[model samples]
Target: MDHEKVNILLVDDQPAKLLAYEVILKDLGENLVIASSGREALEVLLKTEIAVILVDVCMPELDGFELAAMIREHPRFQKTAMIFISAIQVSDIDRLRGYEMGAVDYVPVPVVPEVLRAKIKVFAELYRKTRELERLNQELEDRVRARTAELENSTAKLRESEQRRSMAIAAGKMGSWDWDWISGDWMWDEGQYRIFGVNPESFEVNPANVQALLHPDDVDQLRKAIAEFNKGARAYETEFRIIRPDGEVRWCVGTAAATVDDSSRVVRVSGVTVDITERKRAEERQNLLAREVDHRAKNALALAQSIVRLTRADEVKAYVNAVEGRINALARVHTILSLSSWQGAELSKLIDEELAPYSLGDQIVLAGPEVQLLPATAQTLALALHELFTNSAKYGALSTRSGRLTIGWQVEDQLLTLSWEESGGPLVMTPKSRGFGTRSLLASVESQLGGQAQFDWRAEGLLCRLQVPLTRKTATTTATGKFEDASSAELQRASG
Candidate 1:
């Protein structure tokens, strides 16, 4: 078979057998290394990159199983395929044991060279394909990077060109006017008359007449901008109020650049003026809307919190405490969202923060792989955790200093199981009444998270378990909105 050459390690107790195996594999056009013993095999592995290993299982000192176990322990050799060769007939149990020792296949002694060669060739082909795929992927990534750089450069140049075009259009549509202190005459552009809402044909061009059209409130600013321009101290650019003959007030952006003659005397100050009334009004409206939105969001948050407090008021005083605690938990979730710009809350962080208030001297034990929760899932989980913590603090494990709470979670396939186990608390019994916290926890988890909660109030302590579907859409949407805009004052004080 025409294939990329690969290295193979052949280990045997007898030199003759090793040589024989080497000769058989020589026709395969692979680099074959002969190891007289398992120890020699390990030494060869350290010095060379051996893709596959063929070992005699019944070695005198360290057997093939022992060598395979050692190889499995080494991180570098963990994925290397091992095939065991033994003269003795291998039993079903022995084959199973060999597999447990990380053996890929077992070949009985008096090995058929053709069968061994074929198996080795198959693995070699797989390794070659894997390497080729990796190389192709790397090359594609490089090309993508180069293309991205070129696109980014082009985008930057395009943006720069657009800015220049905008500047040119602004210059062509607007023109500036200036007056020299020594010269009695003033220069005015046609565009300047348009900017000031006066027709050059109808009005006399003079300094006094220009000052007459300016609003009283903008007179000082106009004087200052002009003074700065005349002194060549700064660019004369400002937005000022101008009143038209019809008594309508408008905003205009004025920019001036000065020119001096050979005598070092200011000759002309030229610039552009553009009406900015609409832009200014839009900005004002945006500010008003932003403030209104902030105020309303805060009010909504406060109302939700109040509702939570009022609904759970009738439960034992402790229930009121629980409701307040849950509200705070909700606030914390919002806080995380605010910090993350409402992206999403980390599941591990949420759990840790919720249990912190009730964690008496590190008695609460939490074990779980880190996972992210969508906003709704986070909200639901926060409420559920708050209820659990509150119940524990009032009548369950958290009530006692010596009590311990074990919280853990696991994801199996599409299902997620979050378990809360309690120990060393006063004997627990099912409550006679299903309290508000209990109902809310069930409703939030089932309705909001689309998950089920199992309650087990046993003699030892309360154990609550949750099983939920890890749907992709729910995760993405919740993740996006979970903590978004959470920092707005409205969200901070929100009741629900």
Candidate 2:
């Protein structure tokens, strides 16, 4: 649409000056209204809407500043652009006065034709844009009033349909997609873009880029499904993997069907894709947990069987005590493993549990660096400690009121070395023969855990040292080879 011309008024007593401004600004394609006096300019303004007013400062009666003050007093011309032209030098005070009277700019004569034309052109264009904006705003308000009734009538049904679509998308983590094979058009909804971790503004959806997002192994699987669909398969569901822009791999299940023409030709394909990553991971965890449960059950049963078969006692009471003690030790370690989700058990906690029953006041000191032992290692260590504690209660440190015992361990170069020392007990002596308890301790530390054990017999007390190697799967240590002070340890306080 052609824009209507806005009027630019030039006011001056000299006809030649007014003519010159008209000649210069005529190329701007705006209507130039020339007036000989300020009174004539006011008359023109009342008749026509003037975008810009150019006035000579030295005019008779109504000078440029007076004319400006008069124009600004009228509300219709308050925002009009006014420029004052002067043949004389303007002082700072006069320029300030002109500004206060609503002058937009001042052009000193002889004025540059380009500068005059540029300033007028800017104001004229601004006026046109302002008028155009006002027109558009009015039109929009009219359209809104006309559609109010129609929108109100359809609001409920539209809201219901939207609610259903939103619920389905949220519950299934699903998104819809369409592809026009004939026109090579690919369309995806917001949910569809989100499933693939795509920024809709940045991603250009096309066949090649879509295929690129697929896992290389699953690309052939999807291709095979498409091939089957072409050969008279109406619908197909396939699970595939998509690698997102962030390099995260997610599983998705897509169910699609083709729109077949009368000649049995496929022209379009539409489908919904659901993210199945979490479901796939859950299934994997379930399978792994089942296998782990079976493996651990058999190991526990076999360990229990070994303790039963090897347990020996001359009397029924002793036999029952030995079997029960060993079995309870095994159960305690198993409890730790279960609490840790079978990941491992902490060394301090295992020792604390085994020694908890035989604790005395400040006589038994236990210290160890933080260490995590594998399930099997923890169980074996627990049994060995039970045997040692049983012997102490019967014949060693715990057997005497003045006896003192200290247990400390440290880790270095993936190896854990534990020291068990006893003192202030009845005089110690070497055993004439290795009993069932001694044999079982050796078998547990050495054979089961792939570690070493040494026993030292002294006149004062019995001392034992155990060295166990840690592997990636077997154990881990957080301490940097520093053993905690025996007095400061919480378990030490409990044992004491």
Top candidate on lDDT is 2
Task: Encode model 2's per-residue lDDT on 66-173: one tens digit a residue.
Answer: 999999999999999999999999999999999999999999999899999999888888888998998898898888876885687678679888888978897778
Report every candidate's CA lDDT: 0.76, 0.85
lDDT for each residue of candidate 1 in 256-351, tens digit (9 for 90 to 100): 776777866667666677778888899998987676457536633753564454454554785666556656887788788677655677778988
Off by over 4 Å in 1: 1-306, 313-320, 472-496
> Which stretch of 10 consecutive residues in model 1 shows the poorest summed lDDT?
483-492
Q: For model 2, what is the error of residue 170's alpha carbon versus the real structure, in angstroms, after optimal superposition?
A: 6.1
My TM-score estimates for the predictions, one after another, are 0.38, 0.59
lDDT of 2: 0.85
